[model samples]
Target chain A: MDLLTNILGAIATIILAFVVGMSYGGIVRKITARVHNRLGPPWYQNFIDAYKLFGKTTAIHHGWMQIMGPAFLMVSSVVTLMFVPVLNNGGWFTNLNFKGDLIFLLYLMVFGPLGMALGAGQTGNPNSAIGVTRGLSQMVGFEIPWVMALVALMIQFNTTTITGLMDVQQMSGTWLMFSSPFAFIAAVLAMLGMFRYSPFDIVGAPTELASGPVSENGGKFLFTMMSSGSIFSFVKLTLYVDLFMGGADNLIILLIKTFSIYMIPVLYGIVSPRYRTEQAIRFFWGWPLFFGILAILYAAIF
Target chain B: MINDKNSQKIVDIIQNWARKHSIWVLAYGTGCGAIEIPPTMTSRYDAERLGVRGAATPRQADVLLVTGYLTTKTLKRVIRVYEQMQDPKFVIGFGSCTINGGMYYDSYNTIKLLDKYLPVDVYINGCMPRPEAVLAGFGKLQEIIAEGRANGAQKYKDNLEWYKANQKKIIPSLLTTDYNW
Candidate 1:
């Protein structure tokens, strides 16, 4: 019975986490549209996308490379999942709570998208190459802030376990999002951008470049990449919530806080148009960097 | 959960208006309908506020706007992209190229009716529909959405054969019941 509960918990948590990430994204997109004075999709829109992708026939370039594309994405996302303490919040398989673990894991998150981009580039198509390059450039732009924000958290908290950070928050009764308000603000903004939504989403903008690098990836590679992305996103979001909001035995609390952050990108997307590559990098380098550095200073002083 | 970023009164009003306004279009310009998209997006027919910019990629696009006639060569790419786009994604066949294959009616390359393959939401009429005709089609699309004409899964199940037929026509070698790749 205990084993069954554990297994069920893992499964439910994984499913719920993925759904929340997806649904959270959908909600955010909807809210952004509403913010822009337009009615957008219902909350379930993300799931509809997942289902639709499954329905479409998968394609492969070279049978070997195409097979590896989605495989790498899913594997990378799963690796991303391992580092995140989703249900229990302490740590689990491949948890990176050891010295430099948090930093190591954070860097690891970049691989999934990077691998997907490589897979797309190798398809030997110019259009896909353009898309991947754009994606890589966009990822490069946000990489700095993403690291700085975490460094700020690590500096203030003095520990790197995503779980340890959450433990501190629970014990101190103050979330890091609150610990360094500027860091929280900046990281929230950058992390909101981690998935690379609009203004930053220029990397994979389809109409502009035909789904970017991912345009070339198909068949199981596309499937695994997308499938893992969904679940991996859930784990990532759950980790964020657990770190910032504290974990719960019940799922409702999980829903509220995670959904709140998940909506950040969606809301930003609705009101603004996508930026040019130059503009996107400029915003990341200028505004986010200032805030990220300030966050570090604030962490030091406190 | 405890914090409310915007006041309730304002949020409600804005949310209401947003539901009726901005509509993002993917604008998959393959054949000729693609040609008309530029004029509509330019200053004269500016669709910026309505969120009608052409998304170059399928993932972030809200609607897939078929701009012209799809050839056997281009049709495969179109279908693949059409499938890639996220859900709540609408498909608009913007030219006679898509609606009935226009001048290429008897040509082997053209798919007689695009809807036979994908679930088309709005069908604009014209050998090559003008930008004006495109907008009119969009207005109708918004109306259909408002009236709840988008039935996702049902539309897919009903049009499975159509999509399959298209797959065979475009990527014949790839049109297998099982994808080994």
Candidate 2:
């Protein structure tokens, strides 16, 4: 009975995350349109788009791996969400949140892109190959500082579990953003690349590479990628909130915290021009890397 | 292969509704009328409000907007792009050029009739259709989609032989694959 209940709880959490993620994506579109001085589609436009994709009668596939790509991406996003505590306290929203799962979360996050890369490679499109290469290279560049920041936090709080870190913040009445400003700054900068917006969106340079890795993906395949992308965006924002902004105790607080973090990348994307792959690599390794080191040093000292 | 007519009709209604609301237009510009696209997409017209956003690749696109006249050379590429697009795709022939070759009517290189080469779901007849006319064409497309009258993809598939024969007359060295699938 307990096992069944737990499974149901997990499913509920996944559904909630998917719905909220897509909604946030829609809101972002509306916000972007307003910024451009144009009225956008309805906030539920993404829902209609996804539904239409599923309803599409015509679909083409390259191979088994191509089919597995979006599946892997969706799984990774949901799995990462599962490890993070939804509410600051505990309830139906409280995911598995097992001890030492931070490392697992990090690995699962990267697994999505690696799976996508394998799929993109088989498409026989030169654009897909180029996009995958840039994506993977950018991954390497950003992961260094991102991991460093995570490591610093883990060391400072003496906990590898996300819930443990949240507890430390709550008990001390100080968010990680305030306590470890260096790590916060490093992580935020790394997030610019992670979000894959402008400046670091070399992977999916639509103008240059025709939407990059998913160049050959269409209909249901593209739909799956889109949903997984939204879910992953939510997971990333939630993780940032839990680590830096202090985990929210309720739904409203969670939305407030996550949406603000979400804006950092979305707003930045509107104004900035894209960077080349090499330029992006150098950017991450420069100031962000320096900030990561400073964060580690600060953690070690105090 | 939905055996039940009523169930199939119901499915189509829902599909049509979703399809009409989310027409992802491929950003492939084949001619001079491409100049008007930027304004339509931007704040002045904002076609995105109607869910007619530009797609980067043929794979993900729902609507292929063939702007202005298609030379035989460009026609081959357009046909290839059309074939590459997934099912339930659409073609919108923009400007009088696509209908009757407009200013290029006397040109030896331009194809006189686009429908002979590929199935066109919508045709916006104008010298160079203004952005408003382009949007109106899209609105017509949405109506056709909602009424489930847009069967151009299926038409192309069913009449592939005739289409290919017509295509070969112009581009004798057809470089695209058979596209039988």
TM-score of chain A of each: 0.85, 0.97
i-RMSD values for every candidate model: 8.9, 1.1
Q: What is the lDDT of candidate 1?
A: 0.67
Residue range B76-179, candidate 2, lDDT tens digits? 78987988888889999988888888988899999988899889999998877899999999999999999989999889889888988999999999964645
What digit string (tens of lDDT, one per residue) describes model 1 on residues B20-57? 24455677767766677777776566554354555555
**CA lDDT, candidate 2, residue A90:** 76
Q: Which residue segments of model 1 deviate by more than 4 Å? A: A1-10, A32-39, A87-100, A218-221, A247-249, B1-181
DockQ values for all predictions?
0.10, 0.82
Candidate closest to the true structure, highest lDDT: 2
Error of 2 at A211 (Å): 0.3
Q: Write the per-residue lDDT of candidate 1 for residues A23-120, one digit (tens) a residue.
A: 76566656664665555557665555454345344434454665566777777776666566654444332233466668878778887777676667
TM-score of candidate 1 versus the correct structure, residues matched by position: 0.66
Which candidate leads in DockQ? Answer: 2
Candidate 2 shows a clash count of 0
lDDT per residue for candidate 2 within A1-302, as digits (tens), equals 88888888888888878899999988988988999999988899999999988876546768888888888888888788788778787744665778888888888889999999998888889999999999999999999999999999988888999889988999999999999999999999999999998888899998899999999999888888988998888889889998999899888899999999999999999888899899999999999999999999999999
